[model samples]
Target: MSGLPDRTDVLVIGGGVIGTSAACRLAEAGVGTVLLESGALGSGTSGTTAGVVRTYFPGNPLISSLAVRSLAAYQEFAERTGTDLGLERIGLLVLFTDEQQVQDFRDTRAAQQAAGVDVELVTAAEAARINPLVDERTVLAAAWAPEAYACDPPAIVRGYAAAARQAGAVLRTETPVTGIDPDGLVHTPAGSIRADTVVCAAGPWAGTVAAMAGVHLPVTTYPVEMLLADAAGSAPRDALPMTMHPSSLRIRSWGDRILVGMGRPGPDETRDAWLQRVSHHLGTTFPALAGQGLEHGWSGNLDVSPDGMAFIGRDPSRPFVYAAGFSGQGICQAPAAGEIVHDLVLGKESWIDTAGLSTARCPGVPAGTA
Candidate 1:
């Protein structure tokens, strides 16, 4: 925290989607930028994401609104950059078994509609018609957002990292930040880098990284677990629409495989175990999935901000900026976060409000946890 061996206009911690987007935007703006990642690119939650980019979040107005913007940014950028990110506008089908939960979904869909998201509520009969596989008894109602989408997270992640690098941001792989200083000191295993501004986008490890800077962040990072099936011979032609279950579970198909995940899976189970549990649970819930076999299972830790949104903004007392604790939806919201950080760095007006997500709004430093 003492030495200033290297210098840059901005220093970004964490090379995940959020950090990569920030670096790309910052560098494109001509802000000398340096990005650091503890591991390989897109190896975190971003990698594990089924690439679902939907606007049917429970009732999160801020998140849903920003998701709309982020999704647009992704689509536009992918086209302009000529990156085959495998983005698909497959829509989303959020299922509800409980009547109250169904009502909640209806209300939330209405809210999303009001927020400019093309979301609609459908009856159980209509839902069954949409996806005959959906157990009619288990569904009370459903919401469909046709504009929602999914993509290959690896492509998106690599696209952004590559763009950031091509745009002039110096990127370091497997570069872990050992320490940070409010005034702009970043220590890594390889060397040190100094900057006038430091942005902490350390995904699930945001708390620990913030700690090195004498700051505490309120983020409970947990493992992102999912079950991936190769479809063996019954591979569905990606008709799944990033469906969600009453248990906050989500299922989608990637290539010839299917990936089942959770929007909120207790925050305790590892991906390895969650896959087994979810696969078994799916077997019980839907008899059709009785013999469904899981092929490859993977897990990654995703930082969850207490408020279920990303922690983005400048530290009130310290001269540092941060963007992490995205719960488990960072991949979809990465662009919005980057735009905000880019504007903040450039002294431009914010395109959206991010007050509630301020690291100062909540407390509980990501206390030295693994």
Candidate 2:
């Protein structure tokens, strides 16, 4: 398209993975969809994600259910859309360092099992057998889910965008949304677009986008640093599951390199500082990778809610306005979120219950209508 159309059936804000997924679903449903992005596609948090797809949210049933559904979606993405996502089934190992943590894991495993998730509570030895790179002293027990996967994030985003474009979704990058009215008028520097419905899938900048529509969303963005380093020495090439530490640090194998990540509060962190911290943490936790030199490090923003659960569903006052606050887990649940947002826009009943994720359920958001 030469310029933004004067009007569209649905205007999707943001071109990250979530926005692209939503746009694809809407377009496939035969809606006139226009996706606007401030920067390049997947340049935000979606690009910087660890790309660990797992259904392991213990206490949050909504997230767990969505994750389970998304796992299936990702596994079938290439088959359904004929787009290669570079999906690798490396599995996920949630480590527990003590007896109490192990018991907690066991309880969570029970809940996950009842929800039809295939997870196994393994001993320290079993965990080591699954991934020998970890320090055995730190693992008392672990929850091993074999279906968890890791994928090429940028490729996945491109796949969604390509599919959306093929399905007749207009994608406009470098077009920032300056303003939005409750009645579906979207303002950009180029021109104004009048949409019948608007959906905001902005990742870390969701709060700012919500304010444009006069709705106050409680979304916080934090800086998260991650590093990529080559295997120290004689590291096994395969059969290593994506590992998570009790400290919330995650490490996964990326071919011959290791991907390490940790979330830090506030906005002040240098790349050098993050490298030092991550190197120390990985060395301390794994021991085998101690003193390994990090090859590269980068930082990205993570959108989070107060309760750590996603805020999804229609706005109370403006029913046509919908937002999805994925809170850093957007990739695994993008398809489900897009479908739910689509359903809400069309006033149809969603297969998945979304009452628990409504904006009204969030703090400081009033229940005007849902």
Candidate 3:
């Protein structure tokens, strides 16, 4: 529908992966749902994600369990949503250069194992055997999770949107939410929607949206960049997994090309300087692909929290729930996020323990709240 409905059971703001996933699950459960997006579905940060789905969180059992659950959801995405996400179970290898990181990873691996993740800490030689692209001289050891996977982020968002529509949810694109009331009223340019429950999944704009409802969300935004280079048959790229280099560069296969992602640059760093740093890291880590087909580079923002973890629960005062501060892991964790939102909306007990993910964990939010 081009126009907004006067009322809904649930009004979801943001058409990214998390919002769409929540709408899908809610509508599937027979709730009257309406989703409004400021732009086309997945046009936001969700489309720009590296789309790596791995169940490996360093010593965080809550996040690790959520990752494992979401990985299973992605593996069964096509069967459930009737859309193939082109999931590539290429696996993931996190390389550590020094002994300190190795020891830290030992603890992380133990946490992951305890959380039921099939991951192992392997030697540098074994890492090279798994993927010859590894620079064994620099990498001391690696954590390998052969079940990790990657997929099309935009496709995943569209899949959930489509499933939500099929299940009787109303989704409107190019509809920007301008105001939100604590009593579950959402205002846009077209009209207003009064809902029993509202969801704030607006990615980086989540804090701004929550503030409109008189809620305090401590989510911050940071810029991230990624470059795509032609693999050029170097180092058997087909056998390569989503590899995390010791220099903090994330390397993965994007079809025949290689995707290299660098974290947020320094506050005063110039674009050229950031590119130079990426070039240096790529060349030093993988010598063969130093200057090969450096085709495309792009930037996006991440919704980060002070704790670097997501807040997924209802607000303590407002009638809206939220799933924000995903940092950069929203794509991999959307499925679990959707389930949590669904449970909150219906007042049902969530299977996953959400005490650590509540908004109360944010500074000044207080305990037993969001």
Winner on lDDT between 2 and 3 is 3
Q: How do the predictions measure up, each by TM-score?
A: 0.89, 0.93, 0.95
The TM-score leader among the candidates is: 3
Q: Pick the candidate with the highest lDDT.
A: 3
User: lDDT tens digits, residues 1-370, model 1?
Assistant: 3333489999888888899989988998888988888889877767766677776676786788878888889989988999987777777887877878777766666667776788778888877666555666777788877877767788887899889889888888887898876567788888888789888888888878877877777778676556666553433454767777777666666666667675435558665576567776666445456577765567677788767877887766656788888877887789989999998776687977667667656565432221
Candidate 3, residue 59: how far the Cα is off, in Å: 3.5
TM-score, predicted candidate 1 vs. hidden true structure: 0.89
Better of 2 and 3 by TM-score: 3
What is the per-residue lDDT of model 2 for residues 241-266, given as tens digits with 9 covering 90 to 100? 88988877888887778888777633
> Of 1 and 3, which scores higher on lDDT?
3
The reply for model 3, stretches above 4 Å from the true place, is: 237-239, 366-370
Clashes of each: 2, 0, 1
Q: After superposition, how far is residue 195 of candidate 2 from its true place, in Å?
A: 1.1
Stretches of candidate 2 off by over 4 Å are 265-277, 367-370
